[model samples]
Target chain A: MTTAKRDTYTPETLLTVAVRIFNERGYDGTSMEHLSRAAGISKSSIYHHVAGKEELLRRAVSRALDALFAILDEPDAGRGRAVERVEYVTRRTVGVLMAELPYVTLLLRVRGNTTTERWALERRREFDQRVADLLKAAAAEGDLRADVDTRLATRLLFGMVNSLVEWYRPQPGGGYEGEQVAEAVVRMAFDGLRSGG
Target chain B: MTTAKRDTYTPETLLTVAVRIFNERGYDGTSMEHLSRAAGISKSSIYHHVAGKEELLRRAVSRALDALFAILDEPDAGRGRAVERVEYVTRRTVGVLMAELPYVTLLLRVRGNTTTERWALERRREFDQRVADLLKAAAAEGDLRADVDTRLATRLLFGMVNSLVEWYRPQPGGGYEGEQVAEAVVRMAFDGLRSGG
Candidate 1:
């Protein structure tokens, strides 16, 4: 409405708006017009920040992928028994997912409808393969159960971890802390869910 | 195309086509024109099968919901010890999810943008609550671990179970059978993924 309001637009602020709309209406369904309307900026101004909707998508998924891949390079993720390293990765992943919920949420929901989406999917698969190899190593070391297929187990583990995006809402004032959740995931995953384990 | 080919469009077959399109292009992104094209029929012909795209959505989600709700009523889900009953429901949930993969995928992905989607979401929450109650009963009976929140455990359990839709392609001839996948899910959820009990 005013010059001052229009002057406030930045790439970071615009991206936050874009990611929210992308998650709400879906990446394929959203248009530059939709992002313009949601961000309260003109389409030309948006182009000043990023080339187009796809670039915004690329930035968003890259944030998620970077955080995820960074977990693998951490010292804890690199050292210790294969199972402990895998567990360390799992715990840190839950942290990254919660800390960057919206970005990771968008990353997971990309269906490969565009070039950017396909890239996200490929990077995601690379991350999963890395974790699966860790699970296989843990299995070989007699830490993870050998009865279940490694790839399948890896999918299920991440499935449980990723399902957080579907239902986990951060409550800063009260309710389960993220640490509590990470611990719960570790326990249910490593120790089993049944009593007397 | 021959008149005979055009005449072969049953409501059932048309739904198969509609759901595939809906899953491909999201429900909001799809149109009657798209459905007509995908179904290989005229717009009027598609109208004759159902009222509109919403009807197709409703039918597809209802199929998934009915299958899932039916699991709760099975003898194994009802008659066993609380923990055993919870495990039975979990295993059967995996089976139904695999059996109705596309429909369930659509159901899980619904964002409640339309009346039909909202109804689907409400029904889904009700289904989740029923399973949560089973987990609570198991915890109350001292069969499930008490330290973790029952609700969180329920979500994680179904998270693991529902993740099947993300990456469980059925292979009729050589790959894992439905029963084997079901057994794997049960083993993972009940006993945990550790090497030894």
Candidate 2:
């Protein structure tokens, strides 16, 4: 990318461009040239922003992990009944996923090949375990169904939630929203198909 | 891979090793050196077996696609009631996934970077549409609930099922077999968390 004298590129803006390119071209398939082209800067300018492509991966996954863990710190997530806490986290997760779509998409697609991917995988497991603990608490409190295993339920729930990254597209002109999707998810997951009426 | 006079690798056996490496290192991240090391052969010998990495990917996804489409031809899947056929397809899919775990795992991970990956993606959509049509048929028969969108249910069901590849490990000695797991999946997808009793 050709650089202009006026506005300097910070690591953050450069990273945003890098992550989008990483997603478009699978991370392994992307190169310094691709990032330079996508960022509208030279290869040297790209290196000046971040050390390399791996650094860009590290920064993107860090953003996703931070947002996910932050959900556990919210008041509703920490103080509610176990079932309610699960629901709250579920809703907030959908929001975080949409708000930080590129980062989370990168995090999800990681194959644990590099240092960044392995770290991302570990943090992702921690996030899943936190939700599993919430499910365990719900089960113990007699709120959730007793038949399905808690760990199984947690995986199934997150499987459904994470699947959103596969199909969810933001609306133009402010049409569709993640909140409505999250609410439907909670209802279908908690209540099941038998009609809770 | 220097082809020695005694080179004895078949396409099928070479494919097995190649697909495993592909899944572990990812299709794009893996190189000829990695494949040669994994197969315990020379880089040239690798080509004697399969054309290239993309060809291996095509072969693997073909195995997965064949197994999945074969489910549609089964008498139970083709001739039964819509709800029954849906359950049959779900059961058979779980079986196919377990039986062809590595292939389908690779198939699911394809991101459309190459012609083979794009082909896999198109076939995946076709499979999803077939299942969605089953859901539509069931809804038309007034057996399944109509409040929820059939397409949405199809996505969720496959989301949970496809997720098995991410985490499910079969017992090395003896435990639940494919049929039992398929039964549980069908049960969970249809009757759901409610007491089916």
Local distance difference test values of all predictions, in order: 0.88, 0.82
Candidate 2 lDDT score at position B117: 94
Between which residue pairs do clashes occur in model 1? none
Please report how far candidate 2 places residue B86 from its true position, in Å. Answer: 1.7
Q: What does candidate 2's lDDT look like per residue over B1-197, in tens digits? A: 44333456788888898899998878988898888887778878888777888888899999999999999988899886798898889899999999999999999989898998999999999999999999898888876755667767777788878988887778877755677667666765666533322
User: Lowest-scoring 10 consecutive residues by lDDT in candidate 2 chain A?
Assistant: A188-197
Which runs in model 1 stand beyond 4 Å of their true positions? A1-4, B1-5
Interface RMSD of each: 1.5, 3.5
RMSD vs true structure, all candidates:
2.2, 3.6
lDDT of 2: 0.82
Model 1 steric clash total = 0
Report the number of clashing residue pairs per model.
0, 7
- Tens-digit lDDT track for model 1 on B1-197? 31224646888999999889988877887899888877778889888888988999999999999999999888888997888998898888888998999999999989887899999999999999998898889888898877868888888888888888888888869666888788877777778888765
DockQ for each candidate? 0.65, 0.28
